[model samples]
Target: MNARPGSFGRFVADADAAGNLVVQPRMGFCAPHHMRTGLALTKAAAATTAGTLTIDSYTRVGDLAAARTALGEGAPLNGYPIAAHPAACTRALLDGVVDDTFPVQVRHGSSHPEPIIRALSAAGLDATEGGPVSYCLPYGRTPLDVSVDNWSRGCELLASLMPDGRIAHVESFGGCMLGQMCPPALLVALSLLEGLYFTQHGIRSVSLSYAQQTDTAQDEEAVRALRRLAAEFLPPDVDWHVVLYTYMGVYPASEAGARELLSASARLAVRAEAQRLIVKTAAEAHRIPTIEENVRALQTAARAASTARPAAIAPGGSKGTGDEYTQARTLIEATLELSPDTGRALRAAFARGHLDVPYCLHPDNAGRSRSFIDSTGRLRWSATGAMPVPPAPTSAGRTSVSARELLDAVHYVARRYDAAPAD
Candidate 1:
């Protein structure tokens, strides 16, 4: 199936050119009417915004029958069931809302996204996000090799849409793996690798993601590293951008804290020159946010971004090369040298402990990597496993992070934010 040309990539590029931070909500609904309403509201929001149709879990795991039964029973779903819903239904839902100014991306956490891609393409949508490693490691027990193949197939399917005028844009979720506490270097490395994988499969436009970490300066360095790496590695023709995911870790219980944290993310995006921001609402600590809540969050982020200083002079214009950039470059270059085929290289990287995600317990992951929040709030590696990156400067010759320490590190952001003064 071929998609019509509604360029989500172009829209974001336009926003970046205008120095506007494109804020997007992780919003979804099971019912078509509600979903349509959400998109409409998002498009009408008082900010430069994009739309999202996050796929439901049942459809993500390929359980279409269960999704259908829930639909028939009028049961609410955590997200939109894109695969189970008719293509025509999705088309209708997207019809009036998604356009040049407000492009929509289907956010589905599926290792095997062929069906989802096919359905969205048929419905005239041309953007989505996920990665072979990102979608596989955290979501389920799918083997890394199988997940790699599935994403390869999915990218090929998206590429097939190009002959008819659509250039599908895919965003890499690799940077947000395990949501928090992973060092910025590995996050940046994974995102660049996945973007390369997408390009290797013929995707012409892509976005590399990075989640906001503990320190603002550290996060800025990571985003700069991402842009620098993308420039050095990705093909010249690939239209690419950086996307910042608002702190994906534990949310603050207080509304003020959540809003403050969200505003902080918006500022980070501006300072770091990210083209888009995936926002989290004040209700993040409680439950799924309503349309009003999402809109409020978008507005808040936009306001915050407007007050921020734009990214420094040029891409990678920051001072000396930081450890994050050095480590990420080493990881990416090492992986690329492993095999001409990116998928095989990724599989081999994990197998050889060259690629390891901290706190990720997937069967394929090398569990030796460990990280902790340093005293300065920067995420520092406690252990680097067999990865070629250098040892953490703060390791103090200690080789491991205790379980209780790990628990505290996981909730560090939430606790700090919650205890902060009201805005």
Candidate 2:
């Protein structure tokens, strides 16, 4: 159980430098043995991959008592209850599996993630991903300020693990906000901005995430924008890379369509020059995906990525990003002007309309922004609200969206993908 790659940060960086697409699964189970089984399967898969331990609903919401009870009763919770389980138990679960090369990140959807981080870090895990704003605004009614404070403390704790000379990588969940229909500009801005926030809090080895959007070209533009912005905004000493998530919107229901979409996502990751890709299974549109389904998806992604000629990923600024860069920069610059501290700036930015998420109905969210898939199959802002970004020149412009329009926009990707034959 020696730290082979030694640190998740270094391990992923190695993969990036080697041009290997580091694929990871969102797999988790209520039982510790099941979680271990998933991780083992992922590590043995014939793909460059990482492992994930997603938390159950109770643990995510701070109901460790319920999680503990479920575990005791042998009831099947939705995901692993890492917080309620003892640290030794978690370490055992990861035994012989999680090394430098096979790093596992704890995925918990908690706005106040201090306790969870404490548990995961104590369990000898060095990587986890989430953001104060990204974790809060989308999931619940948690106050923005409270989440910021809690995350600052959590970052400090996770950073403390580096005293043993291993880097604890923290990835930003900001780019994957609301899963779908959020404009890539906002997603890119939030991802980079959150990475900056992590840097300020002393976690230097970080990753910024961008989920696949409606259009392939647009998604490529967004990832390039994120990389360009990272070079410009992130601290020089910090080690960072881009992670792409498969489209988090309403997935294609048909198995053929789902595989096509997943394959496209894998190709997109390579073409965008992302170091890591969070994959989606063919079972995504239905119930929870089994471990076999996850393994198949991982292998499929590896095959797609192996054949890909990754696009050139230099920091080309405007040439790399276009309008996505301009709008995202507007949002980031506006927020930074509010305060030097990343957390405080985020709070102030959202309080005003300086930063907004489209189609996000969270109370703290300004609710003014809305986006829709346009005529060219690109996700475009229908209304920018009070955001600093200019109005999009697309057909889905400043008009209001009715309930029917919103429903159609939500299903836009599913229809688009299903209409075409699987490659």
Candidate 3:
């Protein structure tokens, strides 16, 4: 994989340079043929696309023993176990489908990602997504320090592989903390922090991520904030882009409802000036989406991107994005001042309450931070806790999160889309 511009990161960069929105599916399958077919469908879908090999849970948790057991027993694991799959099979899945036009990224939520990274590297892949804090705090009990060390090695391996045109692209999952409910400022701060970490560890190309949040306007501001911060802090040599995830919260139970929400996410991506999108399917609310469902989502989002208008981005230090830009930067500066090393600073930041996530149950998390939906449906920090949230208009009508309020906030998108008059 001596990519001189052949890497997935470059592929998306070219699309963005052409002002195209690159859409992708969160697709994975246990079978080689199924995974290959998914990539083929994603590549052939009527959209600017990329391929994804989202690894299964067992592999994600580093339970390769169980992954092997499941594979041997033919248990229906949700995703392809790249770390355990025969390298030939995994490589075969992408042989022709993963060319210059159709680059692929391996997505796995692993705190211990070395084996996964090694396997992907062996299969000639250089692009993937995850981060120390983002993948650890929200998903599991993995120690933050341990995850940082593992990712440090993982990033070095990827960066070391930058021979030829193979640029290592690492997308930070930080911005989508808890998928929803966390304030955009914290999300942006974390994502930027992760990008900086990647750069520090040697990844040259990184995609700062922001999930589509509650209010469309708020999300636009969040993306704007993300882009601005990346431009300001990220080194130019570390080529960076932005990727938006569809609403990662509770999905609408109805197909019509789910499609509506998916379209909304695509529009969110385009309007926010994001270059890439991670799409979810109508079957998301029910079960794992089939490849056809994923392809349909890709098409729907591509169509949405085509018709979407550009978002109005307010200038920095202003309330254009509800002061999220200012607040997120504040967090980053505070964290960087912790220590010279990115990993140590991240660990110290979490330990010292300089960085916090709302509603996250991990032990390393400072569970004090709390967020709630405002009357306008924008996610607002009800209690900024230790992280600083500069005064912003979005915080004016912040509702207190009771059990009922929390439930409604979680279902915000689903209810709105499901209640829409069906087509």
Name the top lDDT candidate: 1
Tens digits of per-residue lDDT for model 1 on 301-381?
999999998655657556325888999999998898899999999999999999999888999999889988888999988
Candidate 1 Cα lDDT to native: 0.90
Number of colliding residue pairs in each model:
0, 1, 3
Displacement of the residue 49 alpha carbon in candidate 3, Å: 0.5
Output the worst ten-in-a-row residue range by lDDT, candidate 1. Answer: 1-10
Clashing pairs in 2: 5-100
The regions of model 3 sitting more than 4 angstroms off are: 1-4, 312-322, 390-400
Checking candidate 3 for backbone clashes, the offending pairs are 3-165, 3-166, 4-165
Candidates in order: C-alpha RMSD to true structure: 2.6, 2.7, 2.7
| TM-score (C-alpha, index-matched) for candidate 1 | 0.96
> lDDT of candidate 2 vs native?
0.87
**How well does candidate 2 match the true structure in TM-score terms?**
0.96
Instruction: Work out how many backbone clashes candidate 1 has.
Output: 0
* lDDT values, one for every candidate: 0.90, 0.87, 0.86
Question: Can you rank all candidates by TM-score, best first?
Answer: 1, 2, 3
Off by over 4 Å in 2: 1-5, 312-319, 394-398
Top model by TM-score, which number? Answer: 1
Mind giving the per-residue lDDT tens digits that candidate 3 earns over 308-351? 87765446544234477888888999999999888999999999
